[model samples]
Target: MSIDDTIGVLLVDDHPVVREGLSSILESADGITVVGQAGSGEEAIVLAGALTPDIVLLDLRMGGMDGAEATGHIMRQSPGTKVVIVTTYDSDTDILRAVEAGAAGYLLKGSSRAELIAAVHAAARGETVLTPSLAPKLFQARAKEPPPLTEREREVLQLVSRGLTNADIGRRLFISEATVKTYLMRTFKKLSVSDRTAAVITALEQGLLP
Candidate 1:
């Protein structure tokens, strides 16, 4: 792309040194510009909305809001902006949560300069990027084993198995009926089943229920 077509980037990291280093690296690359930096997730969301960067490099862990929550807000605030998580974490849970929160890419902080540059361009073009080490984990999380159900989901499933209606389940779980439905839906996806009856049966068959 031409210089005028440069991809705008916002770096979000809790560490000033990390943000400075990334800003320098990304700014030196062709067709990329460091538009802003933020030290926390809350600030990142605000900058993302204001700057409307082509890509936002977000840290997964921060003092408050965290990357996932910030990502969700950023996406809502600027739907056209892409979010690329650049964090020290590479766990399956971290990757899945970031993706579920609408991240366009996930790369470890240890990624090489070349990888980082490429990821920025790719993310700006709306392509997903992941470090090689993280790719397998995400794929496995999506396809290999069933997603580990959340504790809330387990409770919802057990209540469903006990012939409780959504209202009863909500009261028993001390959550709203809508929240109970949400938990059930998430459980259904995790168990790879449809409907309450199917989810309950699958959970029992897989020994996922107590």
Candidate 2:
């Protein structure tokens, strides 16, 4: 198909069900086609560079290489390809990091079919989409009291917002799970919040690490 006439999309997610489901959704729409699908971030980078799809629908939480890393690599390799983070996470840092990673839009997994379709269309049109619930936090990101995290604390917090479990964070950061918990506990106290969700919110507000 001609570039001007068709929107080529690549789906990057670990789950086969999600890949097929999104493929079905996009394929049924006129003027769009599922050019390829990737089950992990490494595959996504390769396919995105090779296929040069117009847009990529990426899941944030694959086991090894996550969406943010893939998005960054795609931006570097295929500058024209737009990415939309299709994630279960709505945490402020996750949304912001995807944005910083050069995603064109962020769509929660809870988004309706129409919402997903609209997001893809908008993304193809070079528009950004942040869900309504998240738009408030995104828009007011500069307005919150910043969390006072140490350098290590900040690093852990960023990964935490990406939906990484403490174990995952420990693996990524090369810290013990116990150490991860300790850092997170200190981060929570510093942020003046008591949990993972609130700490992420506080980080976004305070400009601690976006």
Candidate 3:
């Protein structure tokens, strides 16, 4: 295809190898050009504005300004650009955040080169792309009510909100540190968050915490 007929893609990932691998795969495909590669979300935002690529393959987790946040910014800066999240995480929270942030597609890193190329092309066409297996999970997560936290889980998160360390919370509650960690893990799962701060923020937003 001609240069103008090709789909321009901007790749965003914290790891150089990941970006390089993705670029190789994408550039090898017909009608898809790897226009730029960003090693951070901040860089992705700048490139998205400057390059105005047709598609952005963004990593979900990064050191600063995660994929979801970057997707939001890219969409606002270049409304015509379609962002497709390319990450290893298939967690419901991760998927929800990306989609809610205006991502046109959610694709796992394990996807085959064909799948990745197809997703880029599809996204460039303004279609929403999602791995078939994850589509149901996304729908279910959207439809289902937020899982309620157990009383002990709530207590753990409440203590976490107070900026207490796990050991400190365990000591205050007269529980073993391992047990405190277990509660935190359960709370994180139920909250669909990977970190304590997010768990607390999600809980507060959902009125699950005071």
Candidate 4:
């Protein structure tokens, strides 16, 4: 690729040695350039705004503004820039947080050199990259996550928890009994329960209702 077509990358890590190693590996490849390096997430955000690099390889843990938080800032400051998290963390919480914060990729630091290069290219192409072993963890975490409940649904569930019938709930909320039933049905579906008791129990367990 021509110089203009080359991908610009910004490396963010707390350790200078880590940055140097990453730069060396990436610079050894053609069509990829390490444009800048930052010692912290705070610095990463500044350089990201200034350089507007095509990709940012970020570390999850830093002195301040951890990788997930930094990813959010970088995305807002430079919408065209793709942030790829390069971290040693592979926990479900860590991976989910980074992904939810608008990361383009999540790669473990233990990844092979070839995998790292491939992930960078994939992220620049607008693909969601995850360490091969972490994909299942991500999917399982998402599956186990409770569906978000609407305010009205929570209100209905809360009343149900108090032993209120559909009619009583409708009267309390100033809605028709049929409307209350509709809300309950919707809540049941969302909570994946077939009955009111099951729905209430599931909601309580998931903290969807107080």
Deviation (Å) of 9 in candidate 2 = 0.3
Candidate 2 backbone collisions, by pair: 144-205, 145-206, 146-206
Per-residue lDDT, model 4, residue 183, is 95
How close is every model to the real structure, measured as TM-score? 0.69, 0.68, 0.69, 0.69
lDDT of 3 by residue, 20-71 (tens): 9999998899899998999988899999999999999999999967898788
Q: Which residue runs does candidate 2 get wrong by more than 4 Å?
A: 142-210
Give lDDT: candidate 2, residue 111. 90
* CA lDDT of every candidate: 0.85, 0.85, 0.88, 0.88
How many Å off is the CA of 122 in candidate 4? 0.8
| Tens digit per residue, CA lDDT, model 4, 1-210 | 225789899999999999999999999998899999999988999999999899999999998668887887788789999999999989887787688768999999999999999998898889999998999989877777656888999999999999999999999999999999999999876754457886776677667776
lDDT score, candidate 4: 0.88
| True-structure RMSD, every candidate | 8.4, 8.4, 6.0, 11.2
- Evaluation by lDDT, superior candidate among 1 and 3: 3
The lDDT of model 2 is 0.85
